[model samples]
Target: MSGLLGNHFITQIGILVNDIEKTSKAYSEFFGVPQPEAFLTDTLDKAQTEYNGEPSVARAKLAFFDMGSLQLELIEPDEHPSTWRNYLNEHGEGPHHIAFVIEGMKEKIELLDRKGFSLQQKGEYEGGRYAYIDTFKDLKVLVELLENDKK
Candidate 1:
């Protein structure tokens, strides 16, 4: 599994939270940093989100904090069948996924699929796209792949 993902550099950690406002505040107070603004995920037209191989309107409130070399992400999912919502329903609030910034999104997804790691949910953001792979059964945590547009 050494080269499963070209490199092992984790760029972000995502956590599912029932209350983004409260959680963000608590994290800010504890870390002595300002609470980051929370915003909803992009709409279907822009995000092109998919869940379980079907088009989905699942959205979430998100807040991000830059902590040293890694980013801490807080997610509060809407009442939709997304990876975020599913995990929260089954496991309550906790860590959801660890993400890596990678290139060759299509090839990486194909490689993971061949390795039995199915895609759970995927969507697009302003500058990039993200995919959540079903690696919990093996790795005990979901794996997210982020591929940003090259500038």
Candidate 2:
């Protein structure tokens, strides 16, 4: 296994919300930051999505707040069987996951697999790929792995 953890950096904090617009406004007001524009995941290309290791077309409304080096992400899940939706259904709306940006995604995924973390969900965007690892039982939060395209 590769030194995935050593090479990774926590870059984002993700939250699951029942309503994206309200949550975004709340967060913006609380943090004194401007409310971010919401984006729909289904509108993006290269959106290869999955839930619980099965192919899925789950979509979500997403908003992001830039907090210097880290970002705060708010996700409002549609009526779909996605990780976000499941979290919202089972645990209500709250902090869901923390994301790490890394270089070698496949190697890092293999390392996490060897360490017994199951991949709960995955998706690919135009120039990046992301995976959610089921670490809530141990860490009280899911872990997201992000790999951006190399320029």
C-alpha RMSD of candidate 1: 1.1
lDDT of 2 by residue, 1-151 (tens): 3454664567999999988899899988998988999998863245878787778878999999999999999999999898999999999988999998877777877888888888899889778999999988888999999889998
* Candidate with maximal lDDT: 1
lDDT of 2 at 148: 92
The residue-level lDDT of candidate 1 at 13 comes to 97
**lDDT scores for all predictions?**
0.95, 0.86
lDDT of 2: 0.86
Runs in model 2 with CA error above 4 Å? 1-4, 43-45
- Once fitted onto the true fold, the runs of candidate 1 whose alpha carbons sit more than 4 angstroms away are none
Can you give the lDDT of residue 10 in candidate 2?
A: 74
Candidate 1 global TM-score:
0.98
Model 1 CA lDDT for position 144: 99
